[model samples]
Target: MSISRLHIERVRNIQTAALHQLQPFNVFYGQNGSGKTSLLEAIHILATGRSFRTHIPKNYIQTQQADALIFAQAHQEKMGIQKFATGEQLIKVNGDSIATQGQLARLLPLQLIDPQSTDLIDNGAKPRRQLLDWLMFHVEPDFYHAWQYYARALKQRNTLLKTKRQPTLADLEPWNQMLAEYGELLHSQRLSVLQQWQTFFLHDLQMLLPEIAVQIDYRAGFHPELGLANELQHAHSKDVERRYTEYGPHRADLRFKTALGDADVVLSRGQKKLLVMALKLSQIAMLHASNKETVVLLDDLTAELDSTAQRRLIERLSQLGSQVFLTTLDHVAVQQHLNDLSISYQLFNVDKGQIHAVEPTIYN
Candidate 1:
């Protein structure tokens, strides 16, 4: 959803702020420690109902503040959250109260790239699997329900195995059956989405990081030769010993490699940034194909790019046609390149805790 209006209070350094007349592109520029990044972080909270920068909600509220709030209207739907220091929060979507984060996430489809984005490549497969699941959540309508079932069944199965006394196969039969049913659904959905996206996935990857030949393959955790039921049947005793189901879509990964083979950690920082950006672009393409619009929050997009790389990146973003909000500590250096792209934009200055909208800001 593309948010046309935003209301924020007691979030990070900003005590009160509201933005209207939001445009396709937004640039929040200021010097270091001027609260520029906090503005973007606030937008992120509105979209996903949480901050990508930190997991500690209390860390975000202004000091000496007991609560924080963020609300926005997007695609004619109402969404927002109010967080209290007592470890409680309320979420609203489409003017109705929402309890789970998934409910809020379903209302907003968003992608964020920050300095920590490189972790997508350098970290474990868990993060990579999450990135893929985000696509499945939006691409396939039945994914969420199927996923909930699978997670519940997996939990139940694990609980059976963790008893003080080791449980027998008979004890695990029901949950194993449930897990098998929904696990395969998840696997199938992810595989189909990736297959459909392969052509353009590689195209965007190669275009952005041309020097490296990158490849991504789906690794469904269990052996392909075995059916879910058969695999679970065969591993029953071992899983009982391990106290957990060892194989399923939960352990799946998008294996990334290069021409030289297995380039997970070998890519340079700049190259990794470009590759991550490319992946986000591919996701944007997928959303566009499905007739959905996403708000892209880019933090410090110019950090590692040279002049030419910077231009190419901005041009690529312009072509995507999504609402964008990006921040930078230096504005003058990026102004000319933005002008060359001929994209409409709104520029604002961030200082202390205030956001001042620049007048006549849309320069085409």
Candidate 2:
């Protein structure tokens, strides 16, 4: 799915902006603080009901504005999100109000690559786990429901553990049973998706980081032999001490390793970025193969990657039939690469919160 039109209001420095006839590849270029990134943020918010840049709505909402609005038309359906500074949100699809963000997210599956993307490697397991869940949520039809149920059970269990420091085994049985039922399902779903994702990931690794031999290691966060139910029962004391359910799918993680060590440790900064790109690109490839087109938001493309890497990334995205919205400081360089590849795109220049479509300069 691709956005054919987008309208934004009171988001960051962008007071109001609108674009029509967006192409498969859309490029936005400008200097620092020119609102290019803000434009991408608007699209991200519209799709996910949250900003990649910040968790606080007031931070992204225009200064002095009470709320920020983002609306878009994807194919025949129209989706919109309005985030208020008071932490309230209004989401609607096709002019009807919606209660959950998942409804909107299902309509638009977005993959974002930004300067901070390297955190996937260097940071903790949360981001990596999120990567896996993103794929599972899109590919596995039942994954979301399972995840919701598992999350509720996990929360109840953790709260009981925290409130009643010495809660009896009987007290925890119900939550354990719920956790075992849904947790196992989540683990199974994640493993199934990961197995398929690994094939695509390896292909992308060969293309993006051919020299580096990388392996994906998945931790189910519970002992496979004893199973989650038995483990939860056995770890009751530990859970009580920690005030949380420690062993479950909630703590699952994906680790990337090379012969030398973890990718974050062995690879250079540039290599880490490429590896992250490969991970995301592989997800796009897998989704594309399933006939689910992904919309990619690439921030500061030229600054984050070298020319060759940039070309390779763009080429791969195009081949996967991904609709990409890219932000760059050098439109000419990006335009030249797109021209060389004979890729059709819409070029826009962002300045002082204003966005204007510009004609591309053709080169021989």
Candidate 3:
């Protein structure tokens, strides 16, 4: 599935723009600060119904504007042209006009590859855990409801612990029951997803970089048996001091490690980019295997990758056969790879937040 056309008004620097209907490989060329990333972010928002960049929805609105609008038309093989529209600088899917953000995500499934993804490897565990939960939510619809219920209960429980003058270990019994019940189900679902992802990632890694091995491990917040109350009891003092949740799956992490020695840990910036690309390719494979079509948004396709790794990544992306929207600054770079694959793609030259199709004088 791929977005055929997109209409944007008052989104960041893009006051008004229209991206002509796209294809298997759609490339956008422009200089830095020319809104390439913003364009890609718009597509990502439309697909996932959430900003992959900043949490501040207001930031998406133009400086003086109160609201922003993004309209898209996607062509799914089984389901004809699906039109989606959003109001007040929000993300929407299939024009259903849902009030909830998550409801929009279920409609336009997507996998994104951006420079920020390196955070998953070098930074905190939140990003990696989010990846797992995102995939799980798509697979299990009811999981979202369970997640919401648990989040509400957890918030109330934490608030009580913080404000109650006489905080006791036993006071959390009721909340613990609710938290444990939902947490267990969520953990079980995540474990199943991780198992499936392990196979997918291993296979894709072999194809993309056979010399290296990759593994993903899930570490829960605490032992399942301790229950929420017992865990809270153990951390009562710390909780009182911090006045917030010091422990829970929310604090858990997904660890990525290699069997290779520690000396192999030092990866150049470019190598880190390649590793991130490999993971995204693996995610696309998993999404495909699940019988789902995902719209892929790639920001600055040639940023830190060496020519060889770039070619390899492009080839793998092509094999995935999903509709891709990519941005780059090098004309020759895009031409060489697109020619190598002998695939016809649409080219749009972006300038001052506007996009226009550029025709090649000759075909290779």
TM-score of each: 0.94, 0.99, 0.89
Question: Highest lDDT among the candidates is held by which one?
Answer: 2
**What is the full ranking by lDDT, best candidate first?**
2, 1, 3
lDDT of 1 at 194: 89
Model 1 / residue 205 / CA error / Å: 1.6
Query: What shift in Å separates residue 38 of candidate 1 from its native position after superposition?
Result: 2.0
Residue pairs clashing, model 2: none
Summed backbone clashes in each candidate are 0, 0, 1
Model 2, runs deviating above 4 Å = none
> Which lDDT tens digits does candidate 1 get at residues 42-63?
8777667678778888899888
Which is the winner by lDDT between candidate 2 and candidate 3?
2
Q: Which pairs of residues have clashing backbones in candidate 1?
A: none
Candidate 3: stretches off by over 4 Å? 76-96, 225-229, 260-265, 360-364
> By the TM-score metric, which is better: model 2 or model 3?
2
Best-performing candidate as measured by TM-score: 2
Model 3: pairs clashing at backbone N, Cα or C within 3 Å: 4-21
